[model samples]
Target: MGVGEFSYRISISTLIVVFPLLFVFRLAQGQLHVVGSLQPVVAGPGDDVILPCQVEPAFNVAGLTVEWSKPDLRPDPNDRLSRVDYVHLYRDAHEVPDMKLPSYIGRTALFTDSLREGNISLRITNVTQEDEGRYRCFIPKLKSQTRFSIVRLIVDPSLTETVTTKAQLDPENFHVPDLNEEIDNKGGSSERCRLIPVVVLCVFILLCFAVGGCLITESQKAELKKRPI
Candidate 1:
């Protein structure tokens, strides 16, 4: 097998051992999902919390599927497509596929930036006190491959709510250098360029001095011999 296939087999082998315990935890809570699970996202009543629905070790993931739903509310096996209540108003998403989605999309929203990357997390905006229930996320990478996670939503009944900035929308922080250090670095670079020609000229002068000294010494010796002193 190729490296990709070999690695995938090893990975799936390890996951198979751990997946049962993880899925059992989902049963404790009223939640289910397809490929991965959402963290128990918390927010005040009427506020929104964006669940980070993502895959581990970002693979060559293309053509995967994601959706959200409630526990005990799986989609029908007959339909290739299903409808959701969030896309509509307060209707049931039985018309939509349930096996590949997280539970609680009615009051929840999902990050729709690039569905190809398999980010199927839901964002429950305007969180209501009634939404303090179990939420789940599911992703199906292949027909036989899937993952699931669940989050228990809790809302403090008496508190006021505020909006949260989208995690993906936060700005980057750029580091700045000290002014004196920056100036010294630039000065040192220029000095090195200037010193190259100076060094060359000094070497040329030393060579000319050696040649001239030899000629003068020969002349002095000739003069002494001619004077016979």
Candidate 2:
């Protein structure tokens, strides 16, 4: 073969090999994003809610780290509470060693090291009324160190109730069998509380008046006797 033909052939083969590799790398990196499980998850008060998630490019996840966060009601927008990340953590590898507990850390349990088996789940214990919002689970392939953002949690407000109540008292959804029946109950309670005091007061006053009259009659009799009349 001629020198130029050999060089051209070699170059063409090299391009073919390099292009495929670059494409593969890009493909893998594209899907290397963070993805979370189905949200708006429902759970009763005091039960644990596990936020599950995984890295898209799963098996290659080496030395993976996960960060968990629950959206906080904040004054600053885009700073998390407002329109951004409210509460968060660098969980598994970069978890703060000094400050163990976060500010919004109430009755919550976090698991950040479970990305190996594609398990980026947080176990929130005693879920209360305030924990009813979007929770973000950020995961990264620590070996490659490529990071990505995960899905948002949009749970209902009732998921936050942790205390065991006699029954769920949502005054907003107050249902009365009959409107008149409810009114009567309310009126009866008020009247009972009010009339009991009034009746006691009247009885006390009557007793006082009777005692006063007896004293007066005795005094008059004694005075008449002393006057010999």
Candidate 3:
């Protein structure tokens, strides 16, 4: 074969082999896409809210790092140790508390049990009005076209008040007597009152029998004396 022709054939072979390998490599790298709720997650004060975020096609992200943060938050000028403080961080199959902001400490958590299912949703406890804002869910190690998602949170005070009102008005919170229990108590008292009369009549009958027996015994004794036996 001619040198040029051989070279051309080798080039074509290389491309054919390389292209499929590249495709497979890309697949292995995972086309993992982070997804979040499009609508804002509304929550009340003192309520716990979950910011929904997950990977499309379901990936086991148990070993991967997940970062939850506020995109609009600026770095703390006072603390030079951290470039940026995160809302919640999970790494090496555990949460990294040192990387979290003070406001989010002990209040934010990732669903660790669901991490294998690619659920990186964050739960915020005791939500406050200041917590309302857009949140970002990011996976820096994910080699995908989209490695992050944005979700908005809204804390509604009026809604919280309404919920509080309803809770206060709940009948279970009050010490109201149960209708069935009240009826039973009334029935029991009346039954005891009725039993008292029956008990007294029985005692009276026994006493009369005892008195009559005593009188008969006395009469028998007197008859014996009169016989002089």
- The candidate that wins on TM-score is 3
RMSD of each: 26.8, 39.3, 38.0
lDDT of 2 by residue, 1-229 (tens): 4446545755665565556555645544453334454334566656656655555455433354455554243346445543333244454444443332344455444444454555555566665555666555544334322233223333345555543222122232221122222211211112233244345555555655665565556656666677853
Per-prediction TM-score, please?
0.39, 0.43, 0.57
Would you list the rank order by lDDT, best first? 3, 2, 1
Worst 10 residues of 2 by lDDT: 182-191
Distance from true location, Cα of 43 in model 3, Å: 0.8
lDDT of 3 by residue, 13-105 (tens): 556555655565556455456677766678778888878788766898899889888877775778787466789999988999997889999
Count of residue pairs whose backbone atoms collide, per candidate: 25, 9, 0
Candidate number achieving the greatest lDDT relative to the actual structure: 3
Which wins on TM-score, candidate 1 or candidate 3? 3
* Candidate 2 structure lDDT: 0.45
Q: How much lDDT does each candidate structure score?
A: 0.44, 0.45, 0.67
Indicate the worst ten consecutive residues by lDDT in candidate 1.
169-178
Candidate 3 regions with alpha-carbon error over 4 angstroms? 1-30, 76-82, 161-229
